[model samples]
Target: MEKREWKVCVTGGGSFIGSYLVNKLLQKGYIVHATLRSLKDAKTGILRGFPEAKEKLVLFEADLYSPHQFEAAIQGCDFVFHVATPLNHEPGSSQYKNTVEAALAGSKTIFMSCLRSGTVKRLIYTASVLSSSPLKEDGTAFKDFVDETCWTPLNDSLSYVYHDDHHKDYTYSKTLTEKEMLSYNNNENGCGGLEVVTIPCGLIGGDTIQSFASGSIAVCLSLITGNSETYKSLKFLESLLGKVPLVHIDDVCEAHIFCMENSSMKGRFLCASSYVSIAEIAGYYIQHYPEFNVKQEYVEGKKVDVKWGSTKLCEKGFVYKYDTKKILDDTIECARRIGYL
Candidate 1:
């Protein structure tokens, strides 16, 4: 069979990364089965707008809360990409507990469905960097660079201790879900004889193929689109002093494809390109787009020193296509086209 005829399923196809993944898959000539939380959502329009979507794309409605809904979606898929995870960043939101619960339950549902499908050869899971490393509380550098072996020191006790902090809650949930997934992968009886690979990514940023901004792009839009309150609150001067691991969205999608096609690739792959500060990003925008009234404030806070390395991925012979400058330019251009500017 030709490459275009291969079958694959992408859970959460409506997501920022998932949507882009779907587009790339279609371009490669694969018959894509994309899942959405609701067919009426705007993402349906975005997915339908892709070239040849009518011929190559099939849509399925699935929810994390309901695993049974995914059975039909993955029935005959050669590969499965589990890219759906609930994120609630708002502090003091009532949905915080529900978000954590749904994430854990949803992962369980999908993993079991993949095993039961009996057709899935490889399952690529999209995990976050928070699962492996914790942000520095004091804003100091990590004693050493973080690699796949470094697991965040989060547990039941820490969860309770940091209960008041929503960010920590998010971190703890991701850490827990990743641990469970790994444990399931190692289980001789639980995997149902399938291969699993996890990609733990950092802050993902780039020009999205979709019409609207999502994920980290949305945050960047707020910074550049006259959101002075967001700019003032970010404390870019102090926070930018610390190293932040970032990966382009396209790089992230390529990482997923690389893992899916390479049978030997397994375990956790850190998908970050470089560490940069907020000030550098701001400077790029100001220098390139002088017409926009960008905020230039420098507030010195505790210096943060955190580093996440992707040496393992590099050794696997996967090269990143976008650097910091390219990422900024592409992201800004996309934002402007989408009218976020």
Candidate 2:
């Protein structure tokens, strides 16, 4: 049988992770179709990052809330990378609502459309460690290791007091979305014999901070960017110390590509190098860039304690070259490249 040209559609292609995925796919000679709110915005400046691959990057308007908008976006596409989601740490913010709703609605809509279109062969969903395992239940966060087997039961009795409706909603949405996808796997209405891969990654770190300064790694960059006073004053640094697992952006992107090529692989996977403490990362930045380092004393807050395991992905042959040390080194290089170091 002759190999078919992979036509991939990346949702939220204008955003940080999505754009990176688009670039990677385009470079590998795959025809990439990306969704944005508006091509006018993309034309204004979004393609600058991959100036050389501009021709390969096709932008379309496809809102997650609108199913009609997606027909053209996924037409003739063989793969789907659903990377778009609303982000807001503040529990009550509209951003959180939009993120939860969009992810749920948009994801399911795209999957169904792909099934109906009958062209897609595989669907790779970009999920976060947050969905697979959430720490909000214990009033504690994952300051350490987490894996695919872990599930954050927010509605459990343990969080009866603190689990607000919104928190429960977001968690429930993610859980159901993944569960529903699994349920749809072999059904006649679903992917139609298509394969699925869900990657649960931790604090996605990479060489690009300018695009997602408000995202997972941006907090780290903010702390080291002479803005430590705020993080310390709020004792946020304390909560962050020794908490949260870290993963490289490239690895996160690669795992999706790997899963796409490795058709036999199915189900959920947690992609991360290893666990590292915020304090350890802080110490590294302090040593390398004294100008950006702040006193440790100001980082006054309760110590963080959490552990998670990524052995599943590791055992599945997903070797993480960027361990904590390498991640920090690469982060610094990213800073230097962007002139933040």
Q: Considering every candidate listed, which one attains the maximal lDDT?
A: 1
Q: What is the C-alpha RMSD of each candidate to the true structure, in Å?
A: 4.0, 4.7
Clashing residue pairs in all predictions, respectively, total 5, 8
Tens-digit per-residue lDDT, 1-341, candidate 1 = 45456699999999999999999999888889999989999999999999979999999999776657987888888889989887663345443355677678778878778888888877888988766653333323343566787676654443222124445556667777877777776786666568788898877778787777774775554547756544432333123213456678999999899888775556788888877666666666678877875677421223456565559888988999998877777777888888876
- Per-residue accuracy of model 2 over 16-98 as CA lDDT, tens digit each: 67877777787788878888767777332655457545666677887665646877888888888877654433345443355
Runs off by more than 4 Å, candidate 2:
1-4, 42-44, 48-55, 88-98, 134-145, 156-176, 186-190, 209-214, 226-242, 298-307, 339-341
lDDT measured at residue 51 in model 1 versus the true structure, 0 to 100? 97
Per-model C-alpha lDDT, please? Answer: 0.73, 0.64
